[model samples]
Target: MSKKERKLSAAEQRRKEKFLEKCSTMETEGYRMENLSFSVLQINLLSVFIALPVNFLFMFSYFLFNDFSLRSVYLPYAPLLFLLIFLLLIVVHEAIHGITWGYFAPDGRKSIEYGVIWQALTPYCTCSSPLTKKQYFWGALMPTIILGFLPGIIAIITGWEPLFFVSQFMILAGAGDFLIVARLLLHRPKNAQVIYLDHPYECGLVAFLKNID
Candidate 1:
């Protein structure tokens, strides 16, 4: 038997065409594209190192502003429950990316694509259309802020260990996003309309810039 060729679905084809059209428009407009790439393991490890100080700062600030005392929030049978909750939160983390980015996408929810990198066992949400620098930054950082910083702050004020720990984990998980934002800030073109495209499979994204008239 002969192997059959695979065909792209209509939505996939439209996405492919949209990206290509954007590339064409950019080239005609004298725009250039730059990309960053990293492996899943590399990003995760990098995030850990970057997150340490950030997590510490959050903790330090909390302790400085309020009473600090360690108390056991875990119960005898809570380990399994906590584990399940953690897993569910991870899914929510990715969903946050999709939801936030979707808000800024040209096609709205249809512009977001969610998939997993099987080799790395990592889940990702990518935006199919271009987004402004500020928009992209917020989308990339929303999960970190909502799941990590906000909850962590609340936890500190209320002395809730569970929220504190979960928030720290979320902040660490968002290290790659911080790195991306930093790269954009450092390398983005001057006096241009910057658009970011989240890479479909890679850890980083591609940035395109067009000069303002």
Candidate 2:
């Protein structure tokens, strides 16, 4: 026999009710709802795919532009050290997201929430309230620029192999953010104010458009 459906606990039920209520309010306010879900594995795989080519291009450019071999940038560090450093940077990466998002969040830093997805074992930083399209865009892209592209560029210029590698990894790490940005651009309304709210339990967000009527 099929197992009986399990009922939601009071808290879970209330959370679901709250989300539904929010959805209703959004619809009533002329905002459409779009849900995009990505699993942890999918995000990681995408990151890998994106990072490989990017890394290759950057390495190739560095080699072509400069007269030094790739070995010039390689740091003589133990593998364990590199792993530990990468792990630390991962924490910093999430912190960067929270800090940047908090800057533009309506409630300031308090509106930014940090937590881990138990099933995926992935950490996330999300804004509790919605933010303008510009603000959201900056918040979404800050970590990628500051921790990823910028550092990578600097490393390439200064011939710092270790930092360049770490930065490239960060770029890959930010694949999810790039995905969100793409979605926002695709569905964004012209001449309307846009705001987005992070999905509580998913790897995506909800966009709300306020038509300039």
Compared with the true structure, the alpha-carbon lDDT of candidate 2 equals: 0.71
lDDT of 2 by residue, 76-125 (tens): 66456667877787788888888988988878898776766555567788
TM-score of each: 0.81, 0.80
Alpha-carbon lDDT, every model: 0.75, 0.71
Worst ten-residue run, lDDT, model 1?
A: 1-10
lDDT of 1: 0.75
Model 1 TM-score relative to the real fold: 0.81
Q: What lDDT is reached at residue 198 by model 2?
A: 69
